[model samples]
Structures are given as structure tokens and as C-alpha cells.
Target: MNPFVDIILRSCTVYFFMVLALRVFGKRELSQLNSADIVLILLISNSVQNAMVGSNTSLEGGILAALALFVINYLFKRWINQSKTVKDWVLSKPQVLIHNGNVEFKTLAKLGITSEELDEAIREHGVESHKNVKLAMFEIDGNISIISGDNNLKQTHHKRKIHKTLNEL
Candidate 1:
């Protein structure tokens, strides 16, 4: 086979494998990337590169692989949008990890997350403590959504104070 044809074939194979892997791994939103998720993405890209370029070191091989990946991803996204079942399965439903200031230990364990991680997530949302959170959910995309109790009003007040100071300045 000509080097060009070999490159194209390798690219197609890698693109197909990527599509299959993505289907198997389930879909998650980009904003929801956690540490583990990021590592998985990196590993997948590195592992698939050789499969995509084969033994060809030409620029055309790399370009072919990249283009193939783009096309496959575009088609997958289109299909996911049109199919409800596929959407649901690919995008997992949110799981409640904490409720009414109490951590759901079972759920946490199942998600392979620690209470400390949960606490950090809550804090990132500006909640002082878990007690201030009314609801905390682990989104399918690996993000934590925190719904604060009336304590959010306190945060609002703090924000207002800062704005007022800035305005005066």
C-alpha cells in the first residue's frame, strides 16, 4: 500500500475506535471535568495516536487522523442530540450526594468520592459549611451543584457590601 493510503486507513481506524470508546464511556459535559476525567481524556488521546498515524511519520498522516476524529465527533454529537435514549444514557442523571447538611455516605462511596471532596465543592460555591447547604448533587458531568439554604442571603449581603464599597471608591 502507498504511504498515503496507509495513513488514511490508520486514521479511519483510530477515528472508529474513538467513537466506540466514547459511546462506551458515557457522555459528560466539558465543565464537569474532574481530575480523574481529565486523566482519562489525556490517556485516551496518547494511546490512540499511534493507532491513528500507524508507521507513517508524514504530516498528511497526522492531518488525516485529526480530520477523521473531527468528523466522527461531529456525527456522534448529532446523533446524541436526536436520540433521547442515547442522550439519557450518555448523560447520566444527577445523583444527590448531600441533603439537608447530611452527606449521603453510600452515594459518596459509590461515586468514589470523599466527604472532604464534597466539602471542597460546597466551599467553592461560597458556602461556609455543609450545614449551610440545603442540597448538594453530583451532576452527571462530574460537577457538584450546591443549593444553599437561607444562608445564601448572607453571601448576597456580603456581595452587596463589596459592590457598595467599590462604587464609593
Candidate 2:
């Protein structure tokens, strides 16, 4: 196979594998990156770097691989944007973690989110308690979204987790 063709094939393979891996791993990971998560991601990228570009250390080869990855990603996201069914298939549906001031224990458990984590998120928003929150959703992106009693939304400015150290614990 041509080296350029090989680069294309390898990059595409890595990109698709990562998408499938993320889906199987669940949305909790994509929403917040704990220290362990960060380490895992960094390692995965390092491991895949050579796999995507192969032994072609040339600038052209690197640029081709990068271009192929970006193009594939853009096209996939565009396709998802065009079709809700595709979007649903590719991404997790938002889940309700709390409703009417009641914590959805089952949901929290199913999502691998601890009650302590949920409680901390609620308090972080100044809602006082779960009872004061009209609704809380574990969004498809991995952040817990809160709607309080006064029709105000207390949401994290950044989706990335900053202070939490025991996310998986």
C-alpha cells in the first residue's frame, strides 16, 4: 500500500476506535476528567500516535494523518448534527439524576455517580439541598445540570471537573 494511503487508513482506524471506546466507556468519562482519567487519556494518545502515523516521520505524513483525523471528525459531527437518530446512536441521552427535589438513586448508581458527588455538585451551585433543585440532569456531555426552584439554572461554567479528586472512588 502507498504510505499516504497507509497513513489515511491508520488514522481513520484510530479515530473510529476512539469513538467506539468513548461510547462504550459511558458519558461520565467525557464530562469530567479526573486525575486518573487524564492519565489514561494522555497514555492512550501517546500509544495511538505512532499507530496513526506509522513509521512515516515526514512532515507531509504527519500533516496528512492530522488532516485525515480532523476531516473524519468534522464529517462525523456534521452527520450527527443533521440527524437526531444518528446523534442518539452516537451519543448518550441525557439522564435525570434528580427530579422534584428527590435524588434519583437508581440513576446515580446506574451512571456510576456517587451520592456524595451529586450532593457536592448541588451544593456547589448554592441550591442548599437536593430538595431545592427542581431538576438535575446528567447531561450527555457528562456534566450534571441543575435547575433550581426559582427557575434559575446553576451550571458549571466549564464542563471539566476541577476540584474533585475522588470521582471514580
Candidate 3:
């Protein structure tokens, strides 16, 4: 096989594997980037670089690999947008964590979210307590979206860049 073609194939394989891995790992991994998460991402990228380009470390080879990844990514996004079945298969539906001031404990447990984390997210949204929340959703993109039943009907998306312990907050 031509080296450029090989590079393209390898890059495409890595891209799909990454998408599958992220889907299997849960979308929460997308929202928060703790120290360990950053480290893992960095290491994974480094480890996959060789697999993508193989022994051909020339600039053209590297660019071809990146071009392949970009093309596949664009195609994937287009396909997902065009096909409901593909979108559903690739992404999870948002989960309701709180409704009408009631905490959805089962949903929290299923999503591996702790009470403290929920409380933190609520506080982040400026809601004094979960009782004031009209609806809290665990979004498919790994964001905790809070809608308050307060007079203003405020809504907030809790997209945390880094995980913080309760004590640290």
C-alpha cells in the first residue's frame, strides 16, 4: 500500500476507536478535566501518534494523517446531523437529575454522580438549595443544566473545567 494511503487508513482507525472509547466511557468524561484526565488525554495522544503515522515521520505523512482525521470528523458530524438513528446511537439522551425540587437519586446513582457533586452544581448555579430547582438535567454533552423555579426562572449550564473537592470550594 502507498505510505500516504496507509497513513490515512491508520488515522481513520484511530479516530473511530477514540469515538467508540469516549462513548463507552460516558459523556461526563467530556465536561470535566481534572489533573488525571488531562494527563490521560496527553498520554493517549502521544501513544496514538506513532500508530497514526507509523515510521513515516515526514511532514507530508504527518499532514496526511491529520487531513484524514479532519475529513473523517467532518463526515461523522454531517452523518450524525443527517441521521437520527446515527445521532441516537452515538450520543446519549440528557438525564433528569432533579425535577420539581425532588432529587432523582436513581438517576444520580446511575450516572455515578454523588450528592455532594450535585450540591456543588446547584450552588454553582446560585440556587440556594435543590428544592429551588425546577429542573436539573445531566446533558448529553456532560453538562449539568439547572433551571430554577425562582421568580426570574434562571437557567445555567454547569460546565466544569476541573473537578474540585467540596472542601476546596
Give the count of colliding residue pairs in each prediction: 0, 0, 0
Quick one: best TM-score, which candidate?
3
Write down the lDDT of every candidate, Cα atoms only: 0.71, 0.82, 0.87
Q: Where does model 1 exceed 4 Å of error?
A: 1-12, 19-44, 151-169
Whole-model alpha-carbon lDDT for candidate 2: 0.82
Clashing pairs in 1: none
Alpha-carbon lDDT of model 1: 0.71
| Candidate 2 collision pairs | none
Which tens-of-lDDT digit does each residue in 38-116 have in candidate 2?
A: 7988999999999999899999999999999999999999999999998988888888988999998998889787777
* Tens digits of lDDT, candidate 1, 40-159: 999988887887787776787788767777776788779889999877766567889778999889998876666767766776678888887788887765677788886534331110
Candidate 3 residue pairs in backbone clash: none
lDDT at position 76, candidate 2: 91
Cα TM-score per model = 0.68, 0.85, 0.89
Candidate 1 minimal-lDDT segment of 10 residues: 155-164
Better of 1 and 3 by TM-score: 3
Candidate 1 vs candidate 3, lDDT winner:
3
